[model samples]
Target: MVDGATTGLFLDAAGMKALGAAIAIAITGYASAIAEKDIGTAAIGAMAENEGLFGKGLILTVIPETIVIFGLVVALLINSA
Candidate 1:
């Protein structure tokens, strides 16, 4: 076994804050990418069947990107504090 003092694998308050911010952004970005992928695939399929749906498909596909924007805001708040 190891001790905290000897191992020196601890995070101070600032480090913890940075880590939290990074985790928030990373997780949200990944989730948004996954959601966007599925939505984009569906949009493409719809657009293929009906050309008129191109505009709507594009808008729907981009909607998931809002998750990343929220994540960025959260990260900014975390770091600013």
Candidate 2:
């Protein structure tokens, strides 16, 4: 019974770590999506007003993607640990 309890506890800890990693990735991706949505809307408006602004708008739209990259790194670190 003691061994079973110990094994269960260990598995629980591992599960928690996996959950944490998943949450980190999910939250960051969600945040990035929200940010990108707003940015995309604004970019479209800007592009409609001034065709010359397309390059700048594209860069701005892509900036939010870094959030997901950082999240991925954090997830990797959590899993590794």
Candidate 3:
């Protein structure tokens, strides 16, 4: 009952779901990389300190992970819609 011309132009729910999943993963991964970059710099700065700063350094470095968490939530919402 499906037409050939319309077949290529249309995607089933499953296809759309897959696309959403892929986009979610990609966005999260990109955000994770950015977070890592921030952490690396904080770590380097901590290394130069003579007093206690390990905990501060770690916290400052990983703070960028919030971006990834938000990205994940957005992706989930989009997929559900």
Candidate 4:
């Protein structure tokens, strides 16, 4: 059992854990979005120069998506703990 009086901010251990998980996901998701935007811009330029480069550009643009996936995994781990 936990005491409410001890946690003046109203968040207990579980609440803190949830907050931590959320922060992890939010920050990583934001970072991934920024990375995707930059990569997508460059990829679009490359594709414009050579249409055949579309596939490679697409793959490069999507690589940043892994950051979000990692973030989700981290959130899951944090929440589970």
Candidate 5:
């Protein structure tokens, strides 16, 4: 009986950790999307004003993508733990 109870508790904890990792990834992805939206808008405006600014605008637009990459790394760490 004691073993069963301990096993159940361990499963519960593991489930919680999995859920937390999923939430972290989802929230960060959403935030990155929001940031990308604004950055894309600004980049478009800048590009319209000066065609030569395309490279800079592209870099700025892609910067927010790092948030998703970091989120994936964190999720992997959480799951590993």
Candidate 6:
């Protein structure tokens, strides 16, 4: 989008690289959130019925976070360039 004389984003090489990284991070966030949702509800429900399994259930619920960590690593790779 152009606002009169100013363009929305006139990205140079570095800016374009950053933009790509930002997009990758966003996608990673989405995937991680979805993954969490996939396992979290069931884990919580199971834990609610049986509190003894809290440790295992909690770890299982948070397992989705690994995707985000992988995404962070990818973002770091991009940022390093």
TM-scores, each model vs. reference: 0.81, 0.80, 0.64, 0.85, 0.79, 0.81
Model 5 TM-score, all chains together: 0.79
lDDT tens digits by residue: candidate 2, 1-76? 3445435445665777788899999999999999999999999999999999999999999999999999999999
Rank list by TM-score: 4, 6, 1, 2, 5, 3
**Which of the predicted structures, 5 or 6, would earn the higher lDDT when compared with the native?**
5
Clashes of each: 0, 0, 0, 0, 0, 0
Instruction: Kindly indicate the candidate among 3 and 5 with the higher TM-score.
Output: 5
Model 1: per-residue Cα lDDT over 9-74, one tens digit each:
577667778898999999999999999999999999998899999999999999989999999999
TM value for model 1: 0.81
Q: Pull out the clashing pairs in model 4.
A: none
* Clash list (residue pairs), candidate 2: none
Clashing pairs in model 5? none
Per-residue lDDT over 1-81 for candidate 5, one digit per residue giving the tens place of the 0 to 100 score? 344543544566677788879998999899899999999999999999999999999999989999989999999999998
| Candidate 3, RMSD to the unseen true structure | 3.3
- When summed lDDT is taken over every stretch of 10 residues in candidate 5, the lowest stretch is 1-10
Q: Judged by TM-score, which candidate is best?
A: 4
- Cα deviation at 70, candidate 4, in Å, is 1.5
The segments of candidate 1 whose C-alpha lies over 4 angstroms from its true place after superposition are 1-9
Give the TM-score (vs. native) of candidate 3: 0.64
Residue pairs clashing, model 1: none
lDDT of 6 by residue, 18-75 (tens): 8878887899899989988878888888888999988988899888888888888888
